[model samples]
Target: MAGPLAGIRIIELAGIGPAPFCGMMLADHGAEVIRVERIGGRIQATDPLLRSRRSIAVDMKSPEGVALIRDLAKDADGLIEGFRPGVTERLGLGPDILLGDNPKLVYGRMTGWGQTGPYAQAAGHDINYIALSGALHGIGRKGEKPVPPVNYLGDFGGGGMMLAFGMVSALLAVKNGADGQVIDCAMTDGSALLTAMTWGFRAAGMWKDEAGTNLLDGAAHFYDSYECADGRFIAIGSIEPQFYAQLREALGLTDDPDFDAQMDAGRWPALKEKVASIIASKPRDHWCEKMGHTDICFAPVLSMAEAPEHPHNAARGTFIEVAGTTQPAPAPRYGGTPTDAPTPPPQAGRHSDDLLGRCGYDEEKIADLRKAGVIA
Candidate 1:
């Protein structure tokens, strides 16, 4: 069967980082996303984020190029762009004009800050955005500086994924007789929303304001990563009583008097040191053999190179080879409408002629635009 978004069409203003990630998600699920690249743009065919879409290059600096984008967006179901608040307006392709051309379009705007705020036009990255959201403050070990999670929380999770969700929801609303709308997805706002459960915990007085002192933030003796003899790490989370019993049994720690007080917060530091010493006595493989498939919520920490090779990941087809690049497969599988394998990432302007033809431009017009350096 075709994928769920089989009939959806999107116009994506080509960009780096999270915006491309959002487009990738949409295209992976069968949206016909037409990526509008800048003329003479650099091409990286191995970029997984650029896979599963057709590309057409255009010079946004020219009036003809702006007109071309407006033409292509006239019938698009949605459009996604990542730029400063007024950048699109300066380019003369803002939401007011595009939505005028296609009233049913879902115009998704991605930014580190929302369209209207003091920092709306300020330069920032994933680290700064998460820092402002209080998410960064809660990460890292107790009494240590906050460790940025390599941009995962702010860029992909909070930014791209949030924009994708907003686009889909707005599209659904448009389908249900609602007018098209703009989704101002800010990484700061999205990252803040990601801390919803933590907020609840704080409100309930079950969490600490200090980093790494919370129940799930590596302060608990029963939930943290420990290094083995070979210097590899294994994560353990035996939160419930039954699981903690299983963990103790697996580690032969049931008779240890120190482990008797499982939830004693005052004893956590001492107990954690003891658990670390025991775990350090053996290699990761030994623990895996004893507890991998048990209910102790145990897992060996795997690096990016090791992750795809793991048995569980292989069995689940969590990664796939595309264009000689090994990367994560499209997720949240659909049982009734399975998506096909993704197409390879394209070079800039690879589909220029085809896209122009689809937009009702004849060969003469396409050739003229190409000759004028408006498209490539």
Candidate 2:
């Protein structure tokens, strides 16, 4: 069967980072995502991360180009953009225009701060956004510098994924006859939403404000990564007492007095030191063999290259080889409708003529736009 979102048409204004990632997710789940590139074309070649979308190059500054996108929006289910606020409005492709042309269109806007906040127009990156959301403050060792979480927290997880979800939800609402609305998805807002449980913990006095001083944030000896003798790392998440006991028995750490005071915040540092020393005595593979699939919640910290080859991931088909690159497969599997990898990312303006034709532009008009430099 076709994927769940098959037949849905989405227009994606080409952008870096989260916006493209969100488009990729939509296309992966079977939306026909048409990426609108700038006239000169996208800067990068087709890569695994940007796979599965069609491209149509257009000069949005030109009146004809703006009209072309407006025409496409008239028939599109959604439009996603990552331009700073007012950028799209200046280009004449803002939500008001698109929604005026098609009230059912779901206009999804993504940014680091938000559409209208104190920092909305300020320059920032993942770290800045997550920092303001209280995520970065809780992410590192007590006295060590806060480390960037590889852009996972803000960019992909909070930004792109949240935009995709908002667009989908908005589409659903419009389909049910609700008026189309703009979804302003800020990485800061989404990251804060992601910390809902942590906020609860803080309010209940279960979580402290300090970094690396909480149960799940490397404050517990039983819930952290340990570097083994070979320099490879293994992660442990033995949160429950029973799981902790299993972890202790598996690692022969039951006799250590430090392990006994599992929840004593004052003793965590010492316990962590002892656990680290014990773990460093063996290689990561040894720990994997000891507690691979048990309730101890243990696994070797596999690198990107090693992850695809992992037995569990391989058995579950969680990764796939595409265009000579191993990338994650479409996720959250559907029982009945199987989702497949889409065609490789297209060259810029590759589908300009075809897409224009689909939007009711005659051959003559398409040729005219190309000659006028409105459509590449």
Candidate 3:
């Protein structure tokens, strides 16, 4: 607990995917994030997203467990949940009740379609969410069906990160003497927000609505990934004039008259074919050796196993070992107040007694709750 948010406390009602990711983000920055899990939830030790949390398990089906959450929230600066809109309210632990208990609490609600949209109550995943936001539509190769970018777009980037930002912003507002408020963060909304720059380009006619037809969407010959002789890929992003010149020089295309019209979109298909043929003539390492240090905006495609071991990543300490697993380190370094190394993921209910005791429940009461099967 050594970061800018050192003193902040958050109670996370245990969920999956983005909710845990949000909790990890807050905990990484030194917020005290207590994750409340079900009485016997499985623990995922190697999941980096669950690291740095103090786990307390409770059977929220019982009145005692619901009351425990409310009690915990009374002293918490924020609470994040990823249930459907009315789920928490049904549990009697919704924002209305929590904020009543603690007027300064920031209640963050994470969802897919939003709290009040037509699709709010519908079931969906990252692909569906991004699809609704016009994000997934613009993603894929030309003349191909849209390809999902795993779950990064909707789950992590849009959903979890947006909720984390909203939580911090609301917590700061509470510190400034403002009353607490509920944040309704939806993945659909967040994904659209992430595409703001793209929307601007479209509005200005600088972007085409078709997938893979825009400047930054893999249509340009100078900004795409190419296969090497060894079947590996190298990504190039020499968009700017000077960088394109550098790319031409590095690829020995400077003397090729066909490569002169860098911005001619009509010529991109043929130029891309030419570039692909040249890049495929060499191995990935050959291109890496030739242009890795230049301003060509080039990089060899790396797998998850290779990324952490790369010299640049190792030199920057971009990844770390936790619980005998290699994972990304806490990011956006704070020079003045650095964050501590992450603790290992905890077993469900590992800190149940400890957290309840801090909430003023005596050891006997905690034991009673356990005996009654309210807490585990």
User: How accurate locally is residue 67 in candidate 3, as Cα lDDT from 0 to 100?
Assistant: 97
**Candidates, ranked, lDDT:** 3, 1, 2
Encode model 1's per-residue lDDT on 99-201: one tens digit a residue: 9999998999999988988999899999999999999999999999999999899999999999999999999999999999999999999999999999999
- Candidate 3: residue 203 Cα off by (Å): 1.3
Candidate 2: which stretches are off by over 4 Å? Answer: none
Candidate 3 clashes between residue pairs 3 or more apart in a chain or in different chains:
none
60-164: candidate 3 lDDT, tens digit per residue: 878999999999999899999999999999998988889999999999999999999789899999999999999999999999999999999999999999999
Off by over 4 Å in 3: none
| Ranked candidates (TM-score, high to low) | 3, 1, 2
- Residue 44 in model 3: lDDT: 87
Off by over 4 Å in 1: none
Per-candidate TM vs. native? 0.99, 0.97, 0.99
What lDDT score is found at residue 55 in candidate 3? 91
Q: Which pairs clash in model 1?
A: none
Report the C-alpha lDDT of model 2 over 5-115, residue by residue, as the tens digit.
888999999888999989988888888898999998763554654678888999999998999999988999999999999999999999988999998889999999999
Global lDDT of model 2 = 0.88
lDDT of each: 0.93, 0.88, 0.94
